[model samples]
Target: MKETEHSNSSILKEIAELLNEETEIVAMLKGALVKFLNGTNFETGWIFFIDAKGRSELVVHENLPEALAHKDCHYLKKGGCWCVSRYRNEELKKASNIIECQRIESAIAADVGDHAGITHHATVPLQSGQERFGVLNVASKDTVRFSEDELALLESVAFQMGSAIKRILLTKQEQEMALVKERNRLARDLHDSVNQLLFSVTLTARAGIEMTEEDTVKEMFKEIQHLTQDALTEMRALIWQLRPKGLENGLLEAIKVYAEMLGLQLHVTVSGVLQFPSRIEETLFRIAQEALNNVRRHAGVAEAALYITVTATDILLVIRDEGRGFVMDKNTKLLSIGLQSIKDRAKAVGGTADWVSEIGKGTELLIRLPY
Candidate 1:
């Protein structure tokens, strides 16, 4: 008995260490599964998470049986398993010992011939207070019923996992809020300080141009006025991109405003409703900003067309311009900062950025992002 208690203590200590080392929920769950299987009698373990759409998803697993794994388990697919259904229905509120797994039972009833040695399993809901994260399930080949102490230990681990998940989620929300606050602050500072200063400089330079008598002095003042106006334009674009008021309406509106600010005639066509996660919205906006900047500096075109198509699973953005196009392969080593930024932003959001360009023809930039 003392040895068993020591072993349980060691398991809890190892779990604490693993949780401390990991911050992301998926990585934390994967590490916890390995530690749990190594330290306990449980032969297999898996985690399920209820996504934003309220779909039960099998996120990670360890040491799953070959029969189940070979069958490409149905639970891992889009639909929910019996355990998750029971949990969702509030039938299985705690860790319960079972004589059979619902998945195996269904397979047998359906005569799928995949349930060879699968039998009993236990499931514990990973929850904290009123929030339900998902479930932690463990199974073994032997049909031995789990002990009270064993079930209790599993519940304790589930509690820890739930708490960690909740903490991480809250931390992420706080961080995002802080970022929005910082961006708003920076936008205000730029508008009130740098933006106003540039306007003052442009006005002063124009006045000097008119006041100067000598042609050389007048030309110098004209150059200063032109440069100051250019600086003002760039600063305004940066400020708007940082905190676009139009974005509150939607991404399409924001892009239209930005293009207008850049003095580019924009033709925009958007299909489907505009509803997306904040991260995805921000990513698409950044990519569009970079693309438009490239159009202004390199494309030397006055007009561009943006086509946006939204679907249930993904968002596609295409920006095309009939401007002077450059050779991509020869200039690969000389890719501009704007182009690099566009590519990086797309990749960061699990998306792809590709373009087709031909010399003296036109260029098309395409970006696809999964929601």
Candidate 2:
């Protein structure tokens, strides 16, 4: 009785930790997995998150074996297992021990590395009411099956995790919605006020140039008109950044329009389908916009090239400029500011960005995103 009470106390404490709203979804899952692995008989565990696109992502894990953690958890991140298959089919309704870990068996078959004596695991489908999220798998060294009590505990934890995940996902959706609305509002405000004001200033400066008879005064007014026209174009660029109007047509078309706005001619090449998921299209467009801005502002050139290729699982974008390029060093701040955002955005979507350049040899940016 006393041992049961002690175990119950531990479970309650861990459940409370998992229920805390302070941490984001990834951190919470990592922390909770650690607690469970340390507090129980399990030696390793991992959590997978199924996105809206039905893609399985290995979000968090604790004490993963060297074999599974190899190459940044490449094994766990890919391949299908019995647990995942059952979960996808909505057949894994409770915590149950798998006959044998399919991934572990495959690894052993391929002689990847040591399995750390982990051969079997218990699979629990993470679900809140009717909405299923993913799978929670836990294993002990040489363990063949989970006991009744262990399965019960796993079920309870999975329930808590599923609830927490639901809350976090909903919160994210709401935050993104609010951000879109706020961006649109700011874009509209700038277009209606500052944008219009700059256009008026350009017209007034032009009138000044026409009315003046003295050459010196006329030159001054002409300079004013030129500066005001630049300012108007700058304002339009800002508005476009805040709320991209060209994306409605398509990403490639949007890039062409933006390049035109900046007085740039693009040499375009395409290798695949033009359609993409909305989120991916938006991110790619933003990255392209930034790259083109760098070419316009600092490349010392009037034309650039864009290459796009798409596949079922990945998309590659290459932007090149034949302008005077800067040395690849920390001191290349002329284009670094915008280029940094291009890299960061790619990483945000599980992608990579590579830059190739040399002084006076032109610049090339290559970005690859998992579609």
Candidate 3:
């Protein structure tokens, strides 16, 4: 008994170490599951997260018997079993052996074969404080029942796992809130201080140009005015990127305004509704601005068109311009078009960005993002 207790303590310590090291939610969950399976008598297991809306998402899974893993675990994928039902109804409050495993029973009825000596398994509800999140299921080859001591050890591990999950999620929310606060604060400071100073300089330079009598002095004033005006435009673009004031007016209008600011004309077409999730809206808006900047800088054209197709599951955006496109090489096209940055941004949002370009036919970039 003492040896068993010592082993459980070491496993718990190792799990705590792993949980502390992972900052991302999925990585943290995977680490917990791996540690749990590696240290316990259980040979196969999986974790599922039940959202506030009661939707179940399988987060991690480990080695299973061939029967249970058949057809990509078809029985596990769909839920109408006692475990899930008990979890949803708040009845699965403790770790205990689950009898009449419907999923395994179904597999057996179908003659999937190879139960590997397993007739029953254990189920535990994963929760933190008043917040209930998910369920953890574990089994071993041919194990008809799990001992009480083993169930207690599993519950202890699960309790820690649930607490760590809560910590990670709360940390992420706080960090996001702090980032937004800092961004807005910086944007306001820049607009009130540097942006205003540039506008004043531009006005003073214009006055100097009109008042000067000598041609040389007039030319100097003209240059000063032009440079200050250019500074103002760049400053505004930087501010917009930081806070995106135009985004409140919607993505299409925001792009139109930004393109005009860059001295380019924009044409837009849409095939679906305008509403989109907040993150998706921001991602696509930023990508659109980046594409338009590339158009004005390299395309040598004043006009661009955006074609948008919004569907039930995803959105597609195509930004195109008929200008002097560059050769599709590392030196000429990829670097000049800022392809890497666009691709990275899209990938972060679970999407893809690709471009089609030729020396004379201009370029078209397509971005597809799933909801």
Candidate 4:
């Protein structure tokens, strides 16, 4: 009883620690898994989360080989011992000695624990209120298995573990839905505003070009040409705004369109495959927009390169301009808004943006994001 009380207090402290940490969700989850797995009483631990299709996926495992984790799956409704069975019933503590628990022999066999001397096991249902979140399974190589006291410790921690998982899953779902809604709203705005304005401008430019003679119309023609170019630029921007940014057709298409408009000598190139989340793609597009604006407004060079590559599951976006670069300290006052906006957008989506440039060697931007 004394040991059980101490374990309960320790678990409560862990829960408080998790709640107080200002780390990213992924890092927090990894930390939680580590603590759970390294619990003094268990030889192995695993956490299974339900995926989009309602199938259980092995999200975290400690001491379980990759071969077993990848090859097997557990479904909630299918009566799986580790995740499904625990959730179906109300019993929070299900621990058994190797000789007495014949029902779970197959699970033990599938886990390949017979040779590892994993004789004692326990499966605890992790729940937040009435919601069935997931399961935490712990095993011991010794036949002593889990005592009633140990089971009490697990029950104490289960509440905190379940709540954290529920919060993370709900947060991800809300983000995805919000992003889809925002995309729909942007589509409507582009059609209603940009499209109509560009159409009227195109008609006026065509009429001016057709009705003038060479001597008297030289200045008119120049003005008409300028209007035409402006209309084209606006049209391209609209298209960029509306482009369906899938993994295959996102950044490459944007760069290609910009290159065609700016001419072939601009030399835009993309390296490495990109598979960006929708929110990440939108931010990347905005970053590219700002970079191109800088190239056109301040960069006084003929060539620019947009190199994209993935390094260790991270997307690295490098936008380089062979133009005269300005000093950061001097330009911060003038360029603060644009630069700050870009940096904030990147950070919001778990990314970092940096710039490297000298006075004449050209400006290069590096945007790093999770892939």
TM-score of each: 0.80, 0.88, 0.74, 0.52
Q: Which segments of model 1 are wrong by more than 4 Å? A: 1-6, 54-59, 64-80, 83-125, 142-151, 330-336
Between candidates 3 and 4, which one is better according to lDDT? 3
Off by over 4 Å in 4: 1-164, 212-221, 224-228, 242-254, 258-286, 330-335
List all candidate RMSDs to the true structure.
4.2, 2.9, 4.8, 11.3
**TM-score of candidate 4 on Cα atoms, chains taken together:** 0.52
Q: Best candidate, TM-score-wise?
A: 2
Superposed on all Cα atoms, model 1 deviates from the true structure by an RMSD in Å of: 4.2
TM-score of 1: 0.80
Root-mean-square deviation of Cα positions for candidate 2 versus the true structure, in angstroms: 2.9
**lDDT by residue for model 1 over 207-272, one digit each (tens)?**
998888999999998898899888988998888777877878888888888999999999998898
- Whole-model lDDT values for every prediction: 0.82, 0.85, 0.85, 0.63
Candidate 1 lDDT for residue 51 = 48
Residue 161 local lDDT, model 4: 73
